[model samples]
Target chain A: MTMKRLINDPYDVVEEMVEGYVKAHDRYVKMCDLEEAQGRVVVAKDAGTKDKVGVVIGGGSGHEPLFIGYVGENFADGVVIGNINTSPSPDPCYAAAKAVDNGKGVIYLYGNYAGDVMNFDMGAEKADEEDDIRVETVLVTDDVVSSENIPDRRGIAGDFFVFKAAGAKAAMGADLDAVVAAASKCNDNTRSMGVAMSSATLPSKGGPIFDMEDGDMEIGMGIHGEPGVRRGKIEPADAVIDEIMDPILKDLPYEAGDEVYVLVNSLGATPVLDLHICYRRVAQILEEKGIKVHRALVGPFACSMDMAGMSVTLCKLDDELKELLDYPCDTPYFTQVK
Target chain B: MTMKRLINDPYDVVEEMVEGYVKAHDRYVKMCDLEEAQGRVVVAKDAGTKDKVGVVIGGGSGHEPLFIGYVGENFADGVVIGNINTSPSPDPCYAAAKAVDNGKGVIYLYGNYAGDVMNFDMGAEKADEEDDIRVETVLVTDDVVSSENIPDRRGIAGDFFVFKAAGAKAAMGADLDAVVAAASKCNDNTRSMGVAMSSATLPSKGGPIFDMEDGDMEIGMGIHGEPGVRRGKIEPADAVIDEIMDPILKDLPYEAGDEVYVLVNSLGATPVLDLHICYRRVAQILEEKGIKVHRALVGPFACSMDMAGMSVTLCKLDDELKELLDYPCDTPYFTQVK
Candidate 1:
């Protein structure tokens, strides 16, 4: 085992990460004080904004800045953090809804995972039965290679755009229903596919969760080391991007006149230099298709710890989607200024 | 050579990077029009902001978002990009000064390295002889382990704070002398130390820049895989922090009641979860010492492309430094709204 992690007590990685996260981003977030969710829930300080629906997001941990770091002003109102690559408990999910519930209600947003669906749904049930708070859900399904059925597709980096759109809609004084619609709209328009060069090291296990031959690459692999469409010797960046982008662009049926927001994300170990190199290809492809790029974000937004890989996400943009994505927000890992 | 980098034509990495950078961040930056510096210089779109002293920063290519990512509103006015782990040529450096020069002079800020000093000085002299633009410089020397003499020390992630201070000072309409002083003061108060568990891969070489056993870590290494003070088996995060913080705290003579702005930066491959875990220990240590943390930034601000390592930087704070550091600025990688 050759894990390179800066952590103590591998079992306590989650708790320590939360403590450190809240401390480092104290200006934007805080631990949930609610007894039921005490440590598991991280809430934005500006949550429960007047007349706005509560935007609660969560999933497994390890993909840092994803489920937790997005909780901030005009973004996620609260987040339920889980163990690395595992779903959160139902209690924390319920507690997240409780903590962020303004009079307008709450909307639960996350990727389409079986464990998450089972857990968050139960939490929503508890919220409805125990407290009369209305809780809605919008599962992000944007990974085109995951499934032929669009609803069964697993969310990947496109979760960023879906979350941002939902957050912005809620911040604009939308109700739970409207926020859910916005999340669904963004998820429908978003598509992501990734190539993993290596597997992420698991802290508690003290080794990589899976094995990936060093010189090989797996196209369309999920963040948690799930199987992708193909495994072969690594190819040049442009070729790999062309392979991945084809299905995404075709699946969305994105037309030449369409506009998009591009995100070239690093899966933990990939560097910004390489990410930009990949982005250059994505730009070229978009230009060739006559598709206009509204904005481009190149860096690690979602990641697998110590994993070497990259993902490309495209969020087809309309006037409303563009405004929602451009709305200002600030968090520990991401920030946008008006 | 089990390296996994996604780039094309290794020789063209720098040009492609600059092209991708300008395209992705068109809102904040533009390509320098000077034919001699055509693709080598990236200047802030708002450079030459009315009467404000120009803040020019640059170093090499691998450290993306450092020199170029910072060229934006109220930050670095211009950047001279170079090849990987190399310095920019004198012509581009001179062009950067001319491009960003408002009526006030340009201030060149970068890590203190022999190659960079020789090249930028030549550029400064050329600017003076040709364009009559007075360019002042303040080299950042914050890596505590580099040298015994302050000015002889190499710069590391601490470059972020020094450049930020200079940018803020310049944005506030400070004269070249005042901006230089601000950069000097920030550099004097800042200290950094890093650990490298593995070497960063070089694009051109298509392999690791150096080699080490998987579980071993070197303390106080520079970003370019430079040697450090100690090498041993990997230790717990807290233990590692203790080993690193002791020298930084003692070198700065940081005492009780001192306030500091802390930055726990990843050297590429390290994840945000690990960074926060490291920051927790830093906070604990400061608390034990009765030192107050004014603010903390935990992420990959400066990186050594896919290297498995992390660095901690602390800027001892005063009222002036605090105000300048907190001032709002926007760039592709970083943004402070308030």
Candidate 2:
């Protein structure tokens, strides 16, 4: 047996690491004690106008700053952190929503995954039964790879849009229904695709979560290190960017004069230069196609630890969506907004 | 051997990683050339000047985002990255110093090690001769642990003050000489001590860079994973913090009403919660001592890869130092700077 072959159980590792993680990053977050705050995302009491709409988002634990990282801004009232991509308990979701719920109601946004849906849906039901709160769901299905082979694409990292739109609406004091509608619209208009030169080692195993050769990469791996659409020889950076973003552009059938918010996400390992180079080229490609790119983000947005690769997510937008996308935000991993 | 590593050639790993390092984190850094700029820190030419003084700090490679990571507004004008603390050749240091020599003249701040002192002094001499620049230097010697009760106290992880004081001064634009003087002052009042629960593993090694017992850690390990003053069984978190910070606080001869800047640096493997919990007790101790801590930073600044445990650095500051410490900065490994 390999030396690192963990002595304890794998199931126990997440909780242990998170315990360590929480201890380390606790400066940035407070794991909502389901027993205490119930469903609020912010550790403190509601400071944002409760009368305005509320945005809620979340998923598994591995995406440290994603769901939890986005909590401080106007984006989400709460983000339910669970196991790696596994949904949090209904209690936590319900508590987070209930905690943030104003007279206007709450909007729940998330990546498209069976577990998140089931658990979040349950949480919404629980919130409804306990308080006079209306909760709506908007699922982000951005992974073009999962969608290529499968009819329903697995949600990757495009949930960022839902948060932006919902947050903008909430910040504007829009009604809960309007917030939900805007979030849903953003989700529908968004699409993403990713390529990975290597798989992230499971935090527990400390080895490849999945397998690939030294020179090979999966052209459409999921955020959870899920299997991608195509596995082949590693290609040039330019070619890789094309491969990753082409489908995202096409699936949405983006056309000339259509404005969109583009994000080139590095899933760990891939350095900023590589990401910037890829994004610079990707932007040029879209520019050649006459796509009116309003804004762009290239960084480690949603990362799989130590995985060397990238994902391209584009959200087709108009004036309303663009404004929402430009809203301010502050979190552990992301910031700009007040 | 345990497999899975991030670098190729062990000898070239530091340099190779530095290449990707600058390329990856140049977002906040306005100007840096990895290929030509090798061997020294590269500062942005047009970084906004603060009315306060400016501080320039650096060290070796592999501790990325540390030396280079803090180069931004109110932080550092330039950082001179050494070859894993071996100190880059004098030319690169001069080049870097020139790039960051805001009209105020830049202070070359760093740890107080023989290699660093010799190289920086040489770099300073070169800067003076070639560019009509007068550079200042400060050596950080915070380790209370002697090399086995010897006279030599190798500079440990407390170089953080060099960055803070310089960053603060640079933000204020105190002109080069004043900033240099202030940074030197901060260093004079600064002291640090560290303990490693385990050894840091280099990415290329796929094994610990140094050996240690599962239940033991060196109480005064240096940033390069050098042996500490003493090795003993791992103790409770409270005890660990006391052991690390108590000596630092005492060595500074800290008194009541003295304001200070506190930095708890992780040698890598140490998780966040433990750092915070360490902070919790440490903060209380300082309060009881009647020290007015104007600013506090608790995170991984100078890391020893994934080495578990932490170090504490305390810089006794006056009002001028407080003003400098309040400056804003942005880099990859650090954020929430205001």
Candidate 3:
């Protein structure tokens, strides 16, 4: 198959994307100038100027608007950049900590992947050892089917809500511990599952990362072509969403009368029309279950580069989580106001 | 080739999408309840309350955020939706005008397509004859390569800018004529071109609307699979952008010292990662020409279902155009603040 990507080179994709991103959104963010960080860290233009706990989020590339697109006013203070599906180096991670640290402390938020955990922990240790600055970490494990153990579950679309809650808490002048608590609380309430029709075409690989027949789909697939629960011929929109929602609703046992924020996120290439078709089913199922939807976000919030799939994320909301999720924020990708 | 879409019966795609769209974005918009309109018209919750010219935009259904997503506070007051790649019947268009009119006249804005022209004109006549309400229109023709005559060009991604400027002008208490002029002025200043890597899969057809080989790309392809200037092997991002931008910049004769807004819009399935890569080259070209970029929007602002491609739009900014474009507005797909 043709690569079918608009890129100059495989190796330079990340750097070029960053350069274009900063230039396009210069008002909200800037490239981190720290020598140790270089092209691997993006800091909000107003980072280190506010008197609040710092909020940092990061992971592999290809998930646009996940880590980098969330950096701006009242959102993430800085983001550490990684290569496509690969973790960032330790130096840039440490540099992000130093850049966003406002003397109160810094909190790291990311998905629970082994490579990312190892790298971010090293960065936190470096910050503690060098500057004696306190840093806390919150691992978002919201993908319900990734593992049987709750803490071992992988993060997916739910990372958006977890980060939003944490960012808002920090922006509201909460200290490091409070911010971490908020993120953990949101993650605990959040659940996500996805159905993938095809794998993302990696720039380096020049084609799909994995192979599947054109008319088939994998239920509960991870973002990076990780193993899913079942693979079969693509079903109707309602049937596919029904199967995906079963695990999510069952894992949380989201009972009637619960208020939740709904996110129907495109993995990559799924059209907005299909997503809403899927969201229609989700809304029908939720209405049947008597779950009140506080707000619904439908689009490509978190995506795998050019992958054909989508994920549904629900963060069951309480009063506190509601306020935090609804807090005003100005980022390149997301903006809300009073 | 497999359709690879998640949808139910092909005939119900538009109705199902509208059901989910209004449900998901109920905070900003509500389904128009006129028995004549029903699911075909979406009106802002605050429409007809503000004493200003009613702004209504409409087109086919496949473009999601174009017609429906723009209906919200300080934006298009109502949207008339149609079937995929088809125009709305005159009823919804007339209903949209009736729904948004508040003593002040209504102005219809949309791409300049033959079917749209005939149907909207009929809607305007119906409103005048029945309700004694006046409605004016400014058809957008910004697709630079669509025709040699500027007035006959097709509108594509540049519709976003024209609608934004007119919406803000109307919200600022401009009369119908002023709003129409605003849209026309923005359209005159805007130019766009695109390349397509694949054709969008039509729900009704259960396959691509047109055939495109795996690795071939067509420069300046219209959103609905219209033929472009050239078809050949896909080139590097910079080279492809160079080809697309040449006609846009030269046709406008954009000169040094001109300030303009930039939009690198994804044509459905193109990833955000690839768009910024393309934007990097756009910036480079603008810098070389000494053109100043006021602001840049890079995303899937306008799409063609699941077609894999992108378009670049440039709207030259004067003091008036800049003020209008920068005006605060909140919609589901696009939002800005003072």
Query: Which candidate comes out best when scored by lDDT?
Result: 3
What's the CA error at residue A225 for candidate 2, in Å? 4.4
Higher-lDDT candidate of 1 and 3: 3
Off by over 4 Å in 2: A1-51, A83-85, A149-151, A160-165, A181-225, A229-326, B1-28, B32-41, B48-55, B81-86, B113-115, B142-161, B175-177, B185-223, B229-323, B330-338
Residue ranges of candidate 1 with Cα displaced over 4 Å: none
TM-score of each: 0.99, 0.74, 0.99
The per-residue C-alpha lDDT of model 2 at residue A161 equals 73
Ranking by DockQ: 3, 1, 2
Q: Where does candidate 2 chain B have its weakest 10-residue lDDT segment?
A: B1-10
Error of 2 at A175 (Å): 3.5
Could you tell me how far off, in angstroms, the CA of residue A143 lies in candidate 1 after the best superposition?
0.6
Task: Tell me how candidate 3 scores on lDDT.
Answer: 0.92
lDDT of 1 at A138: 92
Q: Between candidates 2 and 3, which one is better according to TM-score?
A: 3
